[model samples]
Target: MSENKNYQHPDVQKAENDELEIDWMEILRKIIAIRKTLYKAAGVGMVLGIIIALSIPKQYTVTVTLSPEMNGDKASGGLASLASSFLGGGTSSNNDALNVTLAPDIVSSTPFVLDLFDTRVQTLDGKLDTTLVSYLDEQKQPWWGYVKAAPSLAIGAIKSLLTEEADSTAALNPFQLTEKEATKVKGLRQAITANVEKKTAMTTITVTLQDPKVAAIVADSVVAKLQQYIVDYRIKKAKEDCAYLEELYKERQQEYYDAQSKYAHYFDTNRNIAFQSIRAEQERLQNDMSLAYQVYSQVAQQLQVARAKIQEEKPVFAVVEPATIPLYPSGISRKIILIGIIFLTICITGGWKLFGYSYWLKIKKMI
Candidate 1:
């Protein structure tokens, strides 16, 4: 074995030993050499961080939690089913049209977002009172946002010059939106979000805005709107059925009144006549009037049941946690931001000094 090891080339053995070695002393020397540059980078990063943190507007967040009632099998022995049996109509199947899982998509929809524009909003300090759209439009942004938007603003200005400007007061069409309306929709979409917990079926709605009072108000409004939408969707079929029954009831009532009037008139006019033919005519009219009355009464009963069905089908939402105005802003503190920026700057500078500089020199020589 010793002879075979000696047979290995000396250069090959040295190369294997070098691959296993780590030069910690050399690494320490490199870090110490760039210590001054790292300090300067950290100081610059701290100043930039402070400026950025101060420029950003403080945001307030409001959260609302809801427990929506789930739809169950109502096809069994309800008043609606009884009425359907009497009317020879089929029983209603289980209605699971709107699931809690879909709350996020519904809230993010364009129409739902547009509906919130007219909601009234006020600043916490009572300095501003306006529609949500006006409030959102007048919001202040960080200085950097303006710098980034400068190119887009210029492009929009040129487009306005080339094309006819859209009327601000025109009615909004969901399918086709004006540039200003589209911007508002985009802003609202970002500011509001809905999430549902799969295990608990608990829906949480969150709204973030510059003003605390406005955020709370919007959060409440969103809850009310979502509940209303769910209620409307669930009971739509019941309402339609009730409306059709109402029309049928009206026609059946009119027919019954006509038949009774004819029967009464014939009996009064032929009171003294003892003829068999006149008696038969009177009996026929009476039978017609009785049948009409029976039909009308059944329809009236069905109509009542249909009306009740609408209320039965309506969904209820229990608010587990109501919206409240936040006492403090909900974002990273300025101190944390400053520390993070400084640490990141130091790491990047030190890395460049140790590795990137040498690699760059090698590339320059190759070029």
Candidate 2:
């Protein structure tokens, strides 16, 4: 492998058993000899890609931001959850357990995401929002219909071949549809969907619509919904922790009362203050009082912390950036489509060359 030398290493002679490979020099020759054909193929590919890009539809993408809350009570849920772990519970380590990073997992299973998918957003403050409905309306008319019931899952495997619509024609989408419409909204939830990164909690939720605006609306709604979910989860967990500790505090108080009662009775019955057992009993009672007070004090403080945390922890998701409708078409990549076309053209040309070779052999036999 010397820089000055162009010779193949002799040491790897066995590995150099000649094998067919792509000939770059021959490729250049082919390009030069059949310049018109290759040029035509490339031009056709470009034109085809451009047409494909323009004809069907253009897609828009919007990115929303999710940031960790920075309040002092940032991870109350994690703290309570960890304490529960100390008490032998699973600890339920939140993806946002420490409010460490914006957890994609926590946000992914977000009730808000489900809510957005479920909630029908027809208008933005009374203006008709045409985004979701546009996708449903394919051509001149609304493609949606009132379905009596969802079709069987098995129907999909044979769908392209099966010409018939499976569902009853009477169903409608629940959001914009009437009570009767609710029954017809098949798999609408799938349109509005989210993906959460497994180990790292970055989320990407998407909603497909004929209109770019609707896609943005759905994405924003999903983020808002996720925020509410995190807040609710933290509050519920805090309350649980506080409730458990309250019970423990009450128990400690009862123990303190019982000890006080025993001490009172012993001192009252023992008229002789010089009794050694009486003195020992009094000392024990004092020790018990001290321990009980401290236990009661600690529990009270924990209850306060938990309650304050619940009140103060407000989860927020700041959309650092949001998706905007792409001005130009952002469909399947042009390069990919072009590469496919080139490959197919090569195969066709090869077939023609083989046909010519065979014809030449046939003529030679005749001669």
Candidate 3:
């Protein structure tokens, strides 16, 4: 009984409980003990990050905004041309509204991007100038490029041996792109972006490049080219309309002259005759001549209108904001990247000490 009492004593009970319970303070101390190791890992990570960030070339971005001219009731002109007297309202027409709507599609098209590959721009230092395609090909590659370069070289060699063509002339055919030019165009598409606002109908184009001046120049050129493309598309249809109207007018004019000549010949031949048959024939010929004159006049008027509309059909672009030379590089900050890497490294190091060591032990046991 005395032994049992000793075993159940308060001091002994307290000691047993103390042994079973966790010592959070001691665990905290253990974590704090490795603070130097954690900081060293973090410092190493930060140094590596700084090195990587410094190696990457800075890129600059330029943005331009344009408002396409909106014609109220674009289809009204075509409707009027088909039936003007039948449904009389406006004298004007909008035969080329499709060109206005498809403006964005033209900007992002592969052929359009390919065209820009030939565009020339100055480098960051302004000491060197080169084409866009050459610049991208010559500039610094991504970190993973070394891994991909081997496969790319092998594939290129295989393709070259398989391909019979000596040059990329066939690639110039917009429908079939050569592998090299296609790759370049794909990269270019990444650099240029075109967006249109549905409600406001305003277009915004952004160009990103290694050089600030080059970015601005490309963006400005894109806007101008887009406007020109739309104008050309619109003019093509307008010119066709003018040609058809001109041909129709000439045909009608000839018919009118022939009818007038026949009527005059009948009048001169039947001047002294008073027969009912001759008189009826004369009236019919006069009516035919009058109908031909009316058609000729109406067709001549439409020809003039068609010519006038061609001038009106040309697309007008309102430059809301033009691209300007960028003063600063729009790339990720080296300091921020370095600091982030340091912080992540510290957290990982601390976590490894707290929990990863146990996981590693379990993994080792399993192994």
Candidate 4:
């Protein structure tokens, strides 16, 4: 009874026995016996991988990093000035009106990507130079695309026949895209990816294309467009303010000049006169001239400030790493592809050596 009490549970005993009963030596022998099959499978796998790698078009990836001068100081100054105007307080508020974080969203927006369709790129050989849309459409697709997109092809053909003239403006509409536009958009989306890091707040853009030179060109174009877009957006309000101020300043300037002319004419008409009424009228005209001058000076100052604000609000973009045409293509990693195929083939061959014959027998019996 005491020995039985000291004994382990059945499940524990079974597990221990199972651990000892592993047939590693037998498994090794089986593997050795199937060495030739393994070798043949590996060879076939490697050959198949090489064939696939060679068949597929090579791709090149280009990356560019941009750091936007997302300074809250300039934005805050404008926002504070705006808030004070409404709240009747001095322009000292620290709230930032412009959201610097929208950089990533703006870069990835459909309109922005669509704009790049017009960007011109040339092949490294300089033989083919075309817009991004044309390049994408002319690129070679895999054989399976024909089979997979037969329905789409039929629909597009029918639409072309029915419609005499498709509106080009519909291309800009995200929801109602023409067949050509959709293809271009899809290609652009796949080829370009933009992201921002929260830690550093730097925007990283990556472009992948069939040609290295084209990839670099497209990447650089994207950065240029992004900077232009940001600058336009940032200075839009300032520019508007400047225009308004300019008009107001001109009006005030004309009024000031007209007042001066009237005062000067009155003085010329009553030169050396010493009447009390004339003196009173002269003082009144002089006061009017002084008031006009003050108002004109103030408007002129405001106009200058508005112009300065437009310049100050302009965002600066720093290129962390500019896109360069890669010397070596980044696509079709033959070595890795070969290794993966060999590994998969080995697994498949091992299965064949184990249960493949049995499975075939079962299939035969079922038939």
Please tell me which predicted candidate would have the highest lDDT against the true structure.
1
Across 218-328, the per-residue lDDT of candidate 2 in tens digits comes to 677666666676677667776787789889888887887887787777778775779788788788877887787777766766665665556654555555566554344
lDDT of 3: 0.79
Candidate lDDT (C-alpha), each: 0.89, 0.55, 0.79, 0.80
Q: Per TM-score, what order, best first?
A: 1, 4, 3, 2
| Alpha-carbon deviation at 347 in model 1, angstroms | 1.1
In model 1, what lDDT does residue 170 have? Answer: 76
The sequence of per-residue lDDT tens digits that candidate 4 reaches over residues 1-367 is 8879888999999987776766665678788998999999999988887776566677899999988776665534574355444444343323445544676677667798889988899999998999887888767665566678888889988888997976654546765776678777877887888888877779889999998999999999988988888788778887997899889998999988888998899999998999999888888898998999998887776666666667767777889999999888786586777788888988998998877877999999999
Which rank order by lDDT, best down to worst?
A: 1, 4, 3, 2
How far off is residue 86 in model 1, in Å? 11
What is candidate 3's lDDT per residue for 46-84, written digit by digit as tens?
888887777777788898988988756544554334444
Going through the candidates in the order shown, the clash numbers are 0, 8, 1, 0
Off by over 4 Å in 1: 2-22, 76-91, 161-165
RMSD of 4: 5.1
Which runs of model 2 end up more than 4 angstroms from their true locations?
1-51, 54-56, 70-102, 106-113, 121-210, 241-304, 323-326, 329-367
TM-score leader: 1
- Where does candidate 1 clash, by residue pair? none
**lDDT, residue 66, model 3:** 89
- Candidates 1 and 2 compared: the better one by TM-score is 1
